[model samples]
Every structure is written in C-alpha cells, then in structure tokens.
Target: MTIVFISDDAQALACGADAVAAAFEKAGCTVERVSSWGMFWLEPLVEIGGLGYGPVRVEDVEGILTRHAELVSASTPHPSSSATIEAWTLERQSPTVKQVQGDDLCVGSLEHHPFIARQQRHSFARAGKTRPLSLVDYTATGGWTGLDRARSMAPADVVAEVTASGLRGRGGAGFPAGIKWKTVLEAKGTTKYIVCNADEGDSATFADRMMMEGDPFHLLEGMAIAAHAVGAGEGYVYVRSEYPHAIAKLNAAIALAAEKLAPFRVEVRVGAGAYVCGEETSLLNSIEGKRAEVRAKPPLPALEGLFGCPTVVNNVLTLAAIPHIMAEGGASRYAELGMGRSKGTMPIQLAGNIKHGGLFETAFGITLNELIHDIGGGTASGRPVKAVQVGGPLGAYIHPDQFDLPFDYEAYSVADALIGHGGITVFDDSADMGAMARFAFEFCAAESCGKCTPCRIGSTRGVELIDRILGSGKTAPDSVEALPQMHNARKAGRSRDEEFQLLEDLCETMQFGSLCALGGFTPYPVRSALKHWPEDFGQAGSAQ
Candidate 1:
C-alpha cells in the first residue's frame, strides 16, 4: 500500500494524519499524512512517491484512487484531466519550485510563463517553487543575504543601498521605499516596529495575493531585513481576511521562519474585510484594535504608529523587493530599469473584464495600450475596449484616447490620474461611463470611514448629484445645459458658476478636504467620465 501525506492548516494535523491512514487502510495501502502543501488552491494535496495530487475533495478520494489505479499500479494521476499524463509531464519540464531545486512538476510555475518571466523577479523567484515553511529551502536560495549584509552595515548604508535601487512603495501611494526606511531608521525610539500592509482591498489587484501564495519567504526575508536595519525586534503582517489562503501560508511561513531564523521574528495579523484598512494609517489603527479610519497625516506611520511607537509601514511588494536589491547589484541595478521618476519593475495586475487576468511586471514607460491590448489580450467580452480603470477603487477611469499615455507616476500625474496599486481593470464598449463615475462615489461613500467631513458627506452628495443629473428630465432644461457647461468648466479650470456648480463644489471638497485617497481621488473617475463620455450623461428624458 502506498502511503501519502497531506498538510492543511485548516485541518488538525493528527486528524489529517488519521484520515490519510484510514484512506490508505481502505485502499489497502500504507498512509502517512504529514502537512498540507502551501498552495491553498490545491488543498488536501496528497504526496506519494515524490508526486503531488489534488485538490482531493473529501468525497472523491475513493474514486480518485480507483480511477488512477493507485490501488494496484501505484502510478500517479494526471494533475488535471484536460491534460494527459504525457502533456503534464512535458509541462513540468521547467516546473516552478520554491526553494529546493528539483524538476518543476507544477503546471502553474510562473518561471515558464511569459507574463511572469519577461521582467525581473528579485523578490518572487522562490514563491511558488519553495516550501513556504522550510527555512532550509529559504536559506539555500540566499534568503538571509540581505539580513546578513544588513547586520554588518551601518543603518545609513542600508538606507543608501535601498535609495540607490529607486524602489517605490507598491501600495497605492508610490512613495520612495528607501526614504521611508531611512526615516524609520533615523527616528529616535527605543522601540520601533516594521509593519507590512497586506490589506489588498482593491478588487482588481492581486499581486500581493500571488506573492504571498507563491513566494512567502521573500516577504519574510524582506520583513527581517527591515527589522534588522531599523533595529526593530518585532514586526506584524496585517493581511486581509478575504485571503484566507494567503493568511494561512504566511502564518505557516512565519512559524517556520521563527524556528529557522533567530535574530528577527515576525507575526501575522488578520484583518476583517474593511476596505479602509488599505490606507496606511487605517491599517495601523486596525492593528491597534480600533475602528479602521484614516488619521490625519503629519504624524505618518513612520514617526508614530501602532500603539504610539515608531513604525516603518510598507506594502508587501516593496518589502519583498528589498532582498533582491541588496543581493544582486544593489538599488542602482533596479533603478536603471524604469523611465524617469519611476524606477524598477512594477508588478501591474490586470483584472476585471480582461481576457488575461494576472500580474505583469514591467519597467515603467510601457503604454496603457500595450498593457491592455498586447499583454492583457483585450477585454474578456471580446468587444471593443471602452475604458480602463488604472489603480484601484480610488483611481481614475481613462478612455481609449488616453491609452497612448506612458505608465509612469509623473506621466499619470500630468494626466490627472494616479496609478494606485498598479491595477488595470478593462471595460468593454458596453460599459456605462456614467454608471462607473457613480460607482467611484459610491465606493468612496461606503469606505470613507467617516473620519473627515468632506469624504463622509461629500461622497453621498456626489452620488445624489449624479442621480439628479441622470434623473433630471426636460422640466429642468437648465440641468441639461448645466451638464455640458459643467464639463467645460472643469476643463477651462475650477469654477463656481451656479448652473452645474454642485458637482464642481463636491469635487473641490473631496479633492482638497478628504482625509485619504478614497475621498481625495473620487473626482478622477467623475471628471474623466464627464470629459471623455459626455454623451453618456445626456438628458435621461431624451434617451431611450
């Protein structure tokens, strides 16, 4: 009888082991259940004779064994039914493994795919390939190189190396990572903390999720480096609850890392599904067990955070890229890859109604058109492209006219948009620009956290005004003229004219007075829709 082992955190270890033993007993084979494979997507993944089989649903175990002839021949079943065993074998030729170097056996290895392979992968090299809980695998791939290098260097040198890389925060803000690290290192504090903001609430972004699932050790290594560099003894990863698999893997990786790496220790904290937690300060407040609300800046997390201690809060990708910067050629090597004011490879996530939905890491300066058409393969609906939302919920909606724009922070800023979290959500020709604009306000209204008046009240007003515009009939001829005049006014420059002044007033309040990006950037989608698709907001009375 063949003995198989499976490791899943959700199931008790002893229970899983007994279940496997019972399955083997029933199959007339020996059973040895160890632990779950790190890949949560393939839970109950069973390993026998160096081969992995899954997703191994509870009810299908008997049929799986019988169908694969495991009871008699001991041959492994194919990874998927769509592909034959021969095809699966061929696919595993360059299989992506995390740490231990072996024949790639998994079909989902990012190393072999063009979408993941073309650009640099300093941080994510070992993600899917390595056993997340194995420090031996992590150390084998030069995992602690950054920590070791950091232990010897002055704090300033560590900061300098990071600065040289030109690494920016992968979070929506796009701030310089090195500068933030330096601030934490320079801050006067007996106790400092390194926090990884893994609350990826953006519906269209999954780079962080993929990184955690594929290469969790890199994240650990990055966190360790930050802890060591800043002399912080403790760190926390505030992962969102939506990512149960990511949270589980990260927790396992953290426990494994703690056992293996002695000097630096990290912990994983789970967040309730609060979109506001994606904000840095809100994340900190959530970590402190408070309502997730945006705090006023000037006392950024760098200076005071998490129980009033000096904290270095960075996005998952930003920290993951650190070890690569230190190990390979330092920051300059990374900085050399991108366009002006935007350096290093950006892991752009193509989600929503796109044919190819996944992460694409490219140097800045790639055009939006290329990202949407060439890499993304256009809309999933197979219809003509209408608009794309760059960034996340708070980002702007850009029409095809803006597709020629280069994808750098400065370039996007010039076009009055911010690339928050590098999410590009494609919309086909059937998309309603007016409805999307309304959604921007609605999202802000739902997630504002009620911290500031402008965000708390203005978003609701924006939605109501949009509804008024959409609901207004011929009785309000002034409203019809006001729509065009309002669109033109925003183009001409900010104005206080009475006709369409309500929306302009709402935009101004949300832009300037809102506490965070949620409120501050609602106008991006609102104004973009008004500018690009003015016809969508034409009088409802006239339209069919």
Candidate 2:
C-alpha cells in the first residue's frame, strides 16, 4: 500500500510523480517522490515492501512489479527498515555525511569530526544532519534563535556583532561581512536587499551546494537575520543552473520557510551557466535580467547594487555563518579559532585527483601539506602529488615546497596566492603545470565579461605565449635568444611586444584596472606558474 520513487533529478521526479501515482493506484498503493539516495547509476529507484528496485527505466515498470511480487513471496537479501534505508540513502553519496554517520573514521561524527567539529559552526552545524525542509526540525536545532535575538537588538548592534566576529566574505574577495552589512545599513536608500550569491562556478568547490542541499534552512535563517539587521524585507539567492539539486532544495526550503516564517519572503534566482556570475557585480546584473557581466566598482555593491538600491551581497557560507555568530556569542569567539588575520573556520574543498575528495572544515592554521597528505590521503591515482591549486580558478598554483604554508589570507598572499573560497585542487605528477597555467589564462579569457581590456585581451595573449614557449619546434639557439627577449619584453612598458611580455603587461593592466576580482586576479595563477614552474615554460622556444 506504499510506494516511493527516487530520482537524481527533481524535475524528472516531479514530472513523473503523477504518472507514478497513477500506476500505484492501479496497483492499489499510494506513491510519493523523494530525492536520490546518491546512487546515481540506479536512478528513478523505486522502493516497495522495504526493497529497492532500479535503474528503474520507464519501460521496466512491469518487470519491477513482477520482481516485487516475487520478492513478497521470497526472502530478499536487501531487506532493511525504511528508516535505515533512508539513512543509508542519504549517507551513501557524501563523504562528509558518511563522516558524520561514523562510516569514515578519520572524519568521525560530522559534529565531532576534527575537520568540521573543531571550530564554531553557528550556521552549518545542522546542515547535513537535519531535515532541510522541515520547520519543526529547523526550530528544534536553534534555527531562528538568531533572528529572534536580532529582532530584539538595534540594527547597529547586529552590525557591530558581525564586525566583532571578524568574519570575511567567503566569495573570494575576503572583504569583511559585517562591514558590508553596515554599508548597506548606513546607505541612504529607502529599500535595501540581501543577496545570497550561490552561483558557485568553481568546479573544485561544493560548499555552497552541499550547504544548500543538506541544511537549506540555515542559509535561509542567515538571510532572514541579514534582512532584519539591514532593514531589507526582500532577499534573493542567485544559484547556478548546474546545481539543479541545490536549486530545487533551496526552492523547497524557501517555500517551507515562507510558510513557517510568514511575512519574510526569500526568492531564488537561477543563473544561466555563466561562471562569471559568481562575481558579485556580474551576479547582480544577471539577477536584474541583464547579461551576466562585470561592472565598475567605484560605487561598490554596498552603495549601489541590485535594482540600484543599497544591498548586502555575501557568499552562501558567509551568510550561513552569521546565525552561528549571533547564536553562539560574538565575532571575537569565532575569530579566535583561526590563525592570524584569518579569523574563522574555513570549509576547505578537497577535489581533483585526490583520494579524499570532500569538504573539510577546519581552523585556518592547517598546512597545505597536511591537507593533501595527512587529511586528503594523497592522490587517488597513487601518483606523487605534483601541484596544488588553492582557492578557485583564479587562485595560484602552489608547489610542494610551499605546502608548509599556513591556510590564511595573508600567508597565502605573501606566497603570491590567495585562499579563494578555500578550494584545494590536487594534481598528481602527470598533471602539466604549463598546460594548467595556459588553462588559467584560457579560463579567464572565456569567463571575462569584457568590461576591461586587460582581462579580455591579456588572457588570449597569455595562452599564445605559453604555447610559443612550450610548443615542440624551436631549437636550443632559439631558446637562448628568446629568454632575455621575453624577460625584457615583460619589463618594457609598451603593450606591443613579444607575446610573453604582452601577456605580462595584460596581467598588470587587469590587476590594476579591472572592475573586480575576476579580471584583476587572473594573473595570480598565471604569474605563479611563470615563477615556480620555469621548467614547464621550458628554455623559451626550445623544442620539447
């Protein structure tokens, strides 16, 4: 009399729900749709009588019914309680979830895991552990307590508390979150907005998606708190289209939260698969139904943002952390957990060629070496770890020698890198640094909004220069002559020069003149490669 449908795609499930319910009625059972249990290979999995049946193709319904009838009469190997099945379903896909469930020893309980448990998590504590859409579950775990507290306090006091937390924007800029909120609060606009930039385009990072999928209410709670503090009644979460799961969960959570916390409505805006939209200004443009492009920053997003109103734009994690800051104590308490100027726990994303590819939340003192070897457990391919790219696409490529470097902004900056979004992408010995460096420029070129000439043209020139240096044609003599010319060309002031020099000049222009981090910091990875991986650049134009 009970039927359950599971799908990796929510829209697919929603679309098929009625058809499935009709089939269930024909068979005298009620049907319900649920999110995938993470075993994507067997999608549209159907459960009846405590047994899972799938890769459940639409044409295989009759087969499933026959199989179920047989299973009813015979003993099934996969028999388990519904609760256990649901628990297994949820835990199977995420290592972070498995860690929370004690399936992985190194990660331990998600709440007590060293990576996630050691530091304060006011916003993320209940994310993976709670029912994302249930208001009762959210409230039971101290959800709206921060909003209630903020409602009682003066807006200035809320801003002061955020400032005290020393929480910086998690959207790669490292700007102070409280300062941003204060700017919106003090701006002379009758209407203000709280924008949650969930357009996480970085392939190596999944913190926002995971947070949205596992604990959507925390993000909503954080946004609600921001609205209360900044006097903004309306908020929007601009999420990337690639994360359909995250979008669906966020939408459902918003609806549930709207019903639960009436009068405060949070809407979600979907992005059109543009990586540049991750940039705040570009995101604002996209939200306004314009082309996703970067804008000049003199006005700053705080002073003039979405719809030309004063707005507070923050990363999903940054806003999610606000509730914890309010609920637990103050900014100083959260700030005390990390090292140096980096005053909070960072949810580090371990991905790309690594054995342990998952989210690791820890204080900002852990070394890159520890992250890759001790925590990540080295390359999945059993190859020697060659290079590590920290932050996101715009972050620098760091060598093993720099692995001892701490995980803080200033520390990374001193090393010509930035801990952007705390993403750590590992590359084994087979990875080509020269190629990666070229890809960095290529990526910039592709994602650049064309608002600045430096990023638009420089990225194109960088790829060509790298190809000229590494391409397999020139001889030793060409190599010897090309090196000094390339170096001098870099030093020269003219934009028209050797391709390498032109690329360098482009980097400088972008760094100094570009509107936002997207164009400004594309040079970080490119320059870092030129500095650290000279061998990959080869002896100028020497043949491979």
Candidate 3:
C-alpha cells in the first residue's frame, strides 16, 4: 500500500504533515510526498491515491496505514483502485476520533469534492495532481505537448493564434498578449529576452505562488514557448524572495527542463520585496541589479527592454495559458470561452474575509455577484456582503449595488475600477470604505519606487489629506474649493470642502503625471470610495 502525504505548502507544513509522512514510512509502507491541495482549513492531508483523509497528525498515520494494509495487503499497484478498500462507503467515527469516515483508508475522493470540482480549471489543471518539479510526472499529465507542437509551427503562427484567442496580460493592464508577442517578434534585436513577472505583491493574491509551487513545469513550458516564438535564447522568471518554496520549485523545474529543451534556458531571479518591482520596467531594473523603479514608456518593453534589447514581458498566468492555447491548436478553443475582447478563462483569487476562499478560474463574463455570493459563499463573518475590491488594494471598493459587474477589463475600467491581476478581496458590511481608500494611499507611499515625483510625493500628501478630511468631518462641496491659505493644513487649517478638493487635486496629479500603474491606478480606489461610500467617510455638518 502507498500513502501520499503533503510535503510543500506552508500551512500544511505548519500542520505537521512531515511527521505523518515519516510515520507512514516507518510503518513499512511506500510513501510519496506531494504538493498541497491549497485548501487551508482541511490540510495535513493524507491520500491513498486520490482518496483523501486529512487534518491528520503523526499519531493518526500509523492507524491509517494499518487500515490500508488490512484493506489491501497484497501489492496492489494502485491503492485507490483496490476493491477491498471500497469507495462511496460512509460511516460514523468514534467520539474519540473527532471525525467520521468509512475507514481510516478512505475519507472521500477529492476529485468530486466541491473545493476542487467547483472550479473551471484549465491553466491550473494539474495543480495538486502532479509533482511540482518532476519533468516526467508533468509530461505524463499532458504538460509539454504544446511546446512539442509549437516547435513545428512558424513564430508568426503562434502569435496569430494568441492574437486570435483574445488572450491578454493577466498582470493587471489587460493588454493583448498576441499583440505584444507580435511586436517583440517584429522588433529589431538579436539579443531579445523573455521575462516572466512573478513579483506578485498584491494582497489577497496568491495564484502565482500556487502555480509555481503546485505546477512549475506548466510555467516553464509557457516561457519556453515564448522563447521559441520570439527567437530569444534566454529567459528569466523574476520571483519574489518572500516565495522561497516557489523559487526552489522554479529553480528545480528550470534545471530539469533546460536539459531537454536546450538553447532556451530559464533562470530564476529573486527581487528585494518592493511592490513597484511588479511593474515590467522596475522588474527589468531589479534584474540588472539596479534600483527597482518604474521606467517611462514610449520604448515599451516589447521594442526595447532588458539590456536595451527587444523583450517579451508576461505575467505568470498569462504565460501559463500559452501551453493550453497552443495545445488546443490556436485560440479558437480558448477564445470562445470568454466574452467580448476579454477572451479565455481568468484565474480569480477568492480571498479576504470570504467563505470558501481559494482560486476560481472561469471565463471573463461571470458576474462578481456569482463569485461573491455563490462561489465565495459571501463573507466568512456570516454578515451581509458589503464591498469587493476586484483587483488589489489599488482597485475600487465596489458596493453591493454594483456586484453585477462582470469580471472583464473594459467593463471594470468603465466603472472607475480595474481588474488588476485578477485578485478579488471581499469585505463584509462592517468594512469602512474611507479606511480602505486611505490605506491605498499609504500603500502607494510606502511602495513607491521614488523615481517618479507624482507617485512618491503625491501619495504621501494624499494620505495626509484623507486623514484630515475624515477627521474634519468633510464632504464634497457644490463647487471646487480654493487651495489652503498656507502650508501645514493641520495648523493653518482649511475648510472641510477645501481639504476635500485638495484630495481630488492630488489624485488627479497622481493619475495623470505618474509614470506607471502604481501611481496611475491609485486614484481608482480612492475616488470610488469617495463616490459610493460617502456616509463612511464622515459627512458634512457632523463636527466631531
């Protein structure tokens, strides 16, 4: 009998899965360590093939192994297929066991479980099913077949398929992926590069971490396909240093895949934790061992990037989707799945104060209401659902009335919001929109690379101004107010309406004058909050 136990996943490790794996091996059974299923509440999971029994400890391993041995003592190649063990059988457990199950050998099949089955997984198809760094295991589960097929087609054809599929960058901007590829392919540079932006610093977002840890080979194949199409000889995956497990898995996957796929080598680079580095130009600067600051456009990364050469910079999920696009023989299979220009599936992260929080991938047309009410099961607090920040901290705090908004890029942009990185952070009714908006300014202030004055200075001023507005009990006046008579508004003091107008001016400066999305997008959340949750931001005539 073989016992499978979780080896990676920080939460699983903390739950003492290593001890359980050790116990199973000591009891004279073959044990394999696999990546986590990523479900937090039910972890330290032990599996007899796909049949799972979890939240178990070191002490429970021996009994489970004993039960498995009793159920199928013979050398069965697959423990899950053993008729003696049986499936779909339910039974009650003793009071001392603290749970109920058919046997210690069987809990239930994870394949049909709601947590796994509820998702329309495509890019995340083999998340918990395959080994994180094993090339052989990755291939057995339909991994590199797309690269094998991409190897035969012309570079233009691959770009054509991506363009036709309506695939866009999942790293927030929602720019067309095929268009970017075409630009890079046509750009004049012999030393072009392929870069994967894995510097994910957004709150409530861990899809990139999950992909790198659970399905590394998928990301590798995606990068390799990009390299082949662009005629690039080198690639870099700039992972965040905070993700030690992801970095280790990516390095291992790179070492193995480099051997089979020669001429195209991928190197893993770690960044100093800076949110601005998630931007492409800043990421390039970090790779060059320079200060991580946003760069000016007009020389898009496609035309002149790393080392001043043409480059293709893509998000982890965007590149991860390449294998699927190529395997399905062009974008037709994936293109039909989404709505309007926002084609194909997006891996939405259901997080923050929400029930059943995890990754849910689906087409772009799904309403936020479905994600919040149905998939998320509303707030974890059991209170009425309030606002939802669809992108990240920079995204708007969408009220419940606007819950019908679709998860499309254009749709969100039209609503004064953004679907940046596809990270959905839910908030319950108790949440204060004013506080959330203020945090956006504070985050921008702390994370600004300081290269652009609008982002660096304006963000700090915005935070200070919001504090005054909230403290002074202000609201927008009937007309724009004049600037404060003197500096240090706290001492000199302006009218509530004047301070409110000052905030609007600061937001405008950040939005129009900033060099990158870090500054340009900060106003989205700020303005949205002031517009929708006026009552929460302290009101006019309410002198505190």
Instruction: Report the number of the highest-TM-score candidate.
Output: 3
Model 1: residue 481 alpha-carbon error in angstroms:
25
Instruction: Provide the overall lDDT of each model, using Cα atoms, as 2-decimal numbers.
Output: 0.72, 0.72, 0.80
lDDT of 3 by residue, 1-544 (tens): 4546455665566788778777777876666556666565556777664556777877787776666555434332234433221231221111212222345445555665666767778898875555577666677778888898888999998888888888999999989999999999999878999999999999988889889988888998889899988889999999998899889888887787787667898899998889889999999999999999788897899998998999999999999999999996547889888888899999998889888677788888899888888877888899988788878878888889998988888898888888998888888989898898899999999999999899999998888788877784343322234345534234436787787778888889999999999998899889888887777778643322
Q: Tell me the spans in candidate 3 whose CA falls farther than 4 Å from its real position.
A: 5-7, 14-16, 23-29, 57-107, 328-330, 472-491, 540-544
User: lDDT tens digits, residues 66-119, model 2?
Assistant: 655554444433322344334434433334333222211111222333443433
For candidate 3, the C-alpha RMSD (Å) to the true structure equals 5.9
Clashing pairs in 3: none
Q: What TM-score does model 3 achieve against the real structure?
A: 0.87
Residue 180 of model 1 has an lDDT of 88
User: Model 3, 425: alpha-carbon shift in Å?
Assistant: 1.2
lDDT at 476, model 3? 36
Residue 406 CA error for candidate 1 (Å)? 1.9
- Report lDDT (Cα) of residue 283, candidate 1: 92
lDDT of 3 at 167: 91
What candidate 2 gets wrong by more than 4 Å, as runs, is 1-122, 328-332, 472-500, 540-544
Please state the error at residue 459 of candidate 3 in Å: 1.0
